[model samples]
Target chain A: MYEAALTLYGEAGWAGFSLDAVARRARVGKAGLYSRWGSKERLIVDALAAWIPPRPSGGGPGPLREELIRLATAIFDSYFDPVGLVYLRAQLEAMIYPDLFGQALERLQRERIRLGRAIVLRAVERGELPEGTSPALVLDSVSGILSNHVLSTPASQRRALLGRRDEYVEQTVDFVLSAVGYRAQGRDGLLSL
Target chain B: MYEAALTLYGEAGWAGFSLDAVARRARVGKAGLYSRWGSKERLIVDALAAWIPPRPSGGGPGPLREELIRLATAIFDSYFDPVGLVYLRAQLEAMIYPDLFGQALERLQRERIRLGRAIVLRAVERGELPEGTSPALVLDSVSGILSNHVLSTPASQRRALLGRRDEYVEQTVDFVLSAVGYRAQGRDGLLSL
Candidate 1:
């Protein structure tokens, strides 16, 4: 039922996707949906929960740079998935509405930031980042970069760039690591999955 | 007339603003707007154009890092101006509605990319950045970070951050320069600013 709701949301946006539509898509009765999820907001949130990629263990890396590249790829691919575009637009547009949709987006951003803090903390423990570096700031910057890429870059351009994900991550990691006083030129590029 | 249209667009969204409303706000007939801009789209485009801050002159600076911080602060403050948020949200939302928005957004992104390229290219000429760094890539990442700061951070947080804009820019410049094999540490931090 939740999957049906997300798919409908992805196709029609929040305004367009009616509860009846979700019932039809899910092949369930309206009463069942109402009984199970209580509201459209809960339905959407539950769908999102089911769709989110599981946290990957950042183990098996030769170096922190390599591990980071591997991690970033998973993150980007999941968030920017083509199926996720509508939800992305919905979430961004939610900022204006500031009701149900807005609350949904706020939750997502907080979760993302928390996850980002964990990543930064891991990097610090591994001695990949400089001491005294603010993980929140670094997360903010990195998240900003990736978000801009998805939101601003043309889809065609993004596809081409994704093909060269290794190169992009390599240069990015090099620049990031270098800026933070960890010279890992030897890592030099993406660590393949 | 253009000023009136910009204010309307800022108050209402692209969908909400209209030619009649613009004429009403300007206290001018609809014909006057049609004569000047030919269409609603063109009018809004010109309005955005009118709001853009002039790019910083490259002549005055100690190094690329110093100049970049100066330029960034100027750009940041300009975009954060009261009307700027409306323009930004409108522009971003337009990208999602490709057919309705036309090529205005594409042109805007290109213009932004071009400005970024100019800054980085000048830095290269001055030997502040590495020889082979792609100007486009660097600009993309830099712009990405800046865009994220604007979109994600709330206004109060932004005001707080702007108060310490010097420190933020110093940290950014310090990191970028160090990563790119330019100057290090004290040279790029707030004391120099």
Candidate 2:
């Protein structure tokens, strides 16, 4: 039912998205939807939360750069997914219905920031990042670059870029680290400066 | 009339936007709109073209980094303006009405890329950038970062950031230059590496 709601929202956008349409698409009774989610706003918030992947556990067993690459790759995957389209629609809707859609978007951004802060803090603790590095700035730069790349590239050409996902991820990770003052060591060595 | 059409489009979105609404908003007869634009698609194309600022007359008289800061500032201003919000709406509308909106978007993007390519080519000629730097890549990175920052930041907080526009432009110019391997000489100095 949630999936159906998202699809309807994506296709119809805010102006056209309706409980009736969602019910029709999901092939469920209006009473069932009302009972489960209570309101469209509640349903949207819950559905978005469900779609968002939890932050990875343990940060894996890799160097800071490698771990960052993994985190970036995961973020890229989620943003390029169909659910991402729904989120984009929600972003547009926020312009019109800030109280409803804005709250949902704020929650999502906060969660992403929390997860990103944890990753950066772990790197700092491991002596990878500088002690006073701003987690918010780092996360924004990394996510902004990735999101911009995806949004600017037309859907038809995205497959070609995604085909070289590892190269893309590596370069982006390197770029972020470099921007934050991490200097690479000799070839194939971990970042030192 | 064009401004009226865009206003209606922004408010109603593509689904609800119509010749009638535009005519009503502009206080003009429907016959005049029909005769002038011939079709809704033609009207949209004309409106978008009118809204987009023409490329700068010249790259301006400054070092490559300074020129880029100016250009980035111009782009950021246009993007954060109300017309920019209308353009963003058109972008989302492109997904649903691809044939109509896609052609309009293609024209706009082509014009922007052409202008960006010209700026980068000039920098390369002056030995500021690498001989083989990809203009498209540079332009995308700069614009993407700016657009994403504006879009992600909520409206309430945008004023604080906009108040420091020069700093934002300077930092973004530095980041893009650095990402492409241009190193700054020193504090308040030209790029050397």
Candidate 3:
């Protein structure tokens, strides 16, 4: 039932989302939907958390740059996944109609942010990043670069992006670490004065 | 007719977008729409280029950091604008149905990238940014950061995001510059050795 609901939402966004449609698509009586999830908003909020792609994970302790690379690689590669669009649709719509997509997405962002912050905080504890580095800005840069790069790339050239994924991820991670004053750990491109 | 097409696309996405619906919304005869556009794809391609919110402009050359802040600020503020949805809808859907949205959106991105690259190149020539700097990476960081930051920010705290808009832009611009090794003229928060 939830799968049916998300498929419908992804196909048309809020304008086409409804309880009736989900019921019809799922081949279930409308009554079941009404009793379980009274409103389309409620149904969608419940459906979205499971359908969105995985964000950067909070892996066990490791080098800060390696940890960020692992996290960013997850974010960068997720955009190419089918579930990624479901995430994108919910996020874009939530901006337009916060009342509908607000609660569900907030939980998701807050959770991912906590994970990201912990990673950065650990790095600071190990003297990798500066004392005042912001996890929001740090993670936001990686997410933004990958998201914007993919979305803005011409479809004709999309295949080329997949080819460069590893290199792109490495460069991005290194660039970010370098900017935050992390000393080079044997990488060649650290910017010098 | 174009206005109606964009409005409908923004509301329901591609699922509810069609020539018949657009004709009804515009109060125009279906035959007229069919005769003019022949397909919804054509109409959307014709319409979207105009309705998208303004992208970061290639204003005449100036300091790299100031130019970047101006451009990033435009992108950050745009997500709050009504027209921003049109841009978002087209971008997300384009990833799913590239054949439909490829050409029109490709032109928009390509042109903006060219302008952005030009901005970075001029700065390098003037000794503001390093000669080896990748303009694509430089501009992509600014654009990507702004896009992701806005999309991930919860709608409930949207007002707070707006309140911190200027400070956010400065931080992002300075962060990108400092990462790329640009010396701070007078800014205090630069990442230092």
Candidate 4:
């Protein structure tokens, strides 16, 4: 049902999103949807929670560039998926419906933001980044680069983008690392530096 | 009429966009809208064209950092305006309706992208950047950075973001310049560099 909801929402803007439409797409009865979600907001919240990629499980901090590369790769790849529409839509809604959508998105993003912060913080601890480095700025740059690249690419060139995803991800990560003056430590892609 | 169209589209997304709604908003007759634009696509094209910022006129390129700061400031400011919603919606729609929306957006973006390219290209020619610096990457980084920063900012903290707008713009531009190994030339903000 959640997948069906996202797929429908992805194809149609908010205009086309309807309980009847979602139920039909999910091949379920209207009663079930009503009983499951009393309101469109509740249904959207639940569907987005379910559809969002799982946060990384507990793991010791890895090298900075590698972690960022992984993060950049994931963000870049997700934009090419159907979820991109949902992401973009949620971002738009957050602008207009700040009270409702803002709280929901903040709740969803809290943990994800923490992970990115922790990675940079760990790097700072390891002396890879200078003291007083802004984790928000660093993480935002990686994400922005990937998001803007995919969003700006012409439709005809998406396949070309996909083919160069790895290269692009590395370049983005490298750019941010250089901007922050990241120092090469024991292990990571930047070791040769 | 165009203002009404963009205002409606910005607030409501594609779902709420219609000739009837626009005519009502503009206090104009439906016949005028209908006669002016036979289809939503036509109306959307004209409305966006009217809404988009005009390309810079015939100024020879200024200092690289100064020019980028102006561009960054403009892009950043636009997101704070109502037009951000329209921009985000168009980006989302382009993903789903690539055949129709893609061509339209491509036509619109070509000139804007060209200007960013020219700025970087001129800098390179002036010996401010490396010979092989990728104009697409440099320009994309600036735009992506600004776009993501605004989109990620939460509602409660918007005023804080606003208070530091100039500072943030310089930080963002400086970060990109540092990453790309930009050389400071005469008459730019980077003279202090």
Winning candidate number (TM-score): 4
Segments in model 3 whose C-alpha atoms lie over 4 Å from true places: A20-31, A49-59, A183-193, B20-31, B49-59, B183-193
- Model 4: lDDT of residue A147: 82
TM-score of chain A of each: 0.72, 0.79, 0.82, 0.88
Give residue B179's error in model 4 in angstroms.
1.5
How close is each model in CA RMSD to the real structure?
6.4, 4.4, 4.7, 3.2
| Ranking of all predicted structures according to DockQ, beginning with the best and ending with the worst | 3, 4, 2, 1
Q: In model 2 chain A, which range of ten residues has the least summed lDDT?
A: A183-192
lDDT of 4 by residue, B77-116 (tens): 7776666566657766777777767776775667667888
Worst 10 residues of 2 chain B by lDDT: B183-192
Among all windows of 10 consecutive residues in model 4 chain B, the one with the lowest summed lDDT is: B51-60
True contacts kept of each: 0.28, 0.19, 0.76, 0.52
- B14-128, model 1: which lDDT tens digit per residue? 6556788889988988887778777777787777655553455555744676667776666566454435445454544454455444355556666767777776777666556
| Sliding window of 10 residues with minimal summed lDDT for model 1 chain A | A184-193
Q: Rank the models by lDDT, top first.
A: 3, 4, 2, 1
Please give the DockQ score of every candidate, comma-separated.
0.24, 0.34, 0.63, 0.58
Highest-scoring model, lDDT: 3
Q: For candidate 2, lDDT tens digit of each residue in A104-155?
A: 6776656666777887877776667788877866766676677656555553
True contacts kept of 4: 0.52
